[model samples]
Target: MFNRTENLSLYIKKYPVISVLIGMNLIVYLLGLIPGIGNNLYALGIAYNYSISQGEYWRLITAMFLHGGFLHLLFNMFGLYVFGPELEQLAGKLRFFSIYFISGLLANVATYVVEPLNYASLGASGAIFGIFGAYLALVYHTRKILPQLKQLIIPLVAISVIMTFVQSNINITAHLVGLAVGFILGMFQFTPKRIRRFREK
Candidate 1:
């Protein structure tokens, strides 16, 4: 299964950023498992909370790369593999990265703002969902250009959202916030003029 997935991932060479991001996530995850090092990895999540109150707010951006457990990293990386390359291909790497990081940051901000006291959240769901939103934007904008893709987008997003709700211990707020931000950003990122310009021959 892993080999097959890797082979499939290779086809997305046009989107180098996705691959690099995935690699970074995996590396961090592995490094986090190194006994004492793992504690530091786990701390990255809560570190932001401490930093925020101390006026060193940049930890918000740093925490997105940290995951709490094997499954957490798995799901986030898997989601990125599933949605990220497509967005990268459509928007190009720089724009895709921007949307991803910004959306993730927004999700973190939402979490921090809404539940200021409960500060144990981590993972790249926000950024991945941003990619999901960007994908939605791309599909919606190009719906007229390529109507067939609509069938794929709607069902995939619906199923993912439903599954997110069903899964326990999942940060529902982060996912929703990420999706919402992604959807909103997708609107502007996939504007008609931009899409037309990107697709120009």
Candidate 2:
């Protein structure tokens, strides 16, 4: 079901939220390339715990779009490009955007609460993990229909978590919280039976 067969225009038409987000990330990254301007945006956008506590709450959202470098942006956007469309199709655009955006925001919030005051970070990894978590929830319930996804997602999550620790300079707090939040949200968003349970209340 996850395939990259569509051209750029068609892909965006099919998954506009994903397109806009990826575009936003690219635009922000490009802005960060401007000599004087880039540094300013970086300072303002990076998720520094001290700044966040001091009331720069916008960083939580901005940090999700900001990247330390091209490779960071490339890897994240690529991940989104690869995995985002199916969820968008499954959850519909608005809910899909909610899962992605909320995951990233809370991930930054968790980092602020849990990390050292001096801690600073930038990237879309948390949001990406959120997508994974939500997809995981869906794949799990529908596993009887699509058995391969369980096999795929479990190993993927484990490996991602493992690398989160083994790799230096990674924000473990954001990743874990994002995953947890996504899974919880997914429980509501992806499951028709669960959604009906809530609506009946």
Which prediction has the highest lDDT against the true structure? 2
Candidate lDDT scores, in order, read 0.76, 0.87
lDDT of 2 by residue, 1-201 (tens): 566999988999999999999999999998889899999999898998899889999998889999878988998899899988878877888899999989999999889888899999999999999988997787667677667878778887888889889988888988898888888889888886743343355
lDDT tens string, model 1, 1-201? Answer: 112244645655655887788888888888887999888666644425545776747667777888878888898887777667656766777888888998999988887777665466778888888877777877788889978877878787788789889988666777888888898888887788877776683
Model 2 vs. true fold: TM: 0.93
Off by over 4 Å in 1: 1-13, 47-51, 196-201
Q: What is the C-alpha RMSD, rounded to one decimal, of candidate 2? A: 3.8
The residue pairs that clash in candidate 2, if any, are: none
How many times do residue backbones clash in model 2?
Answer: 0
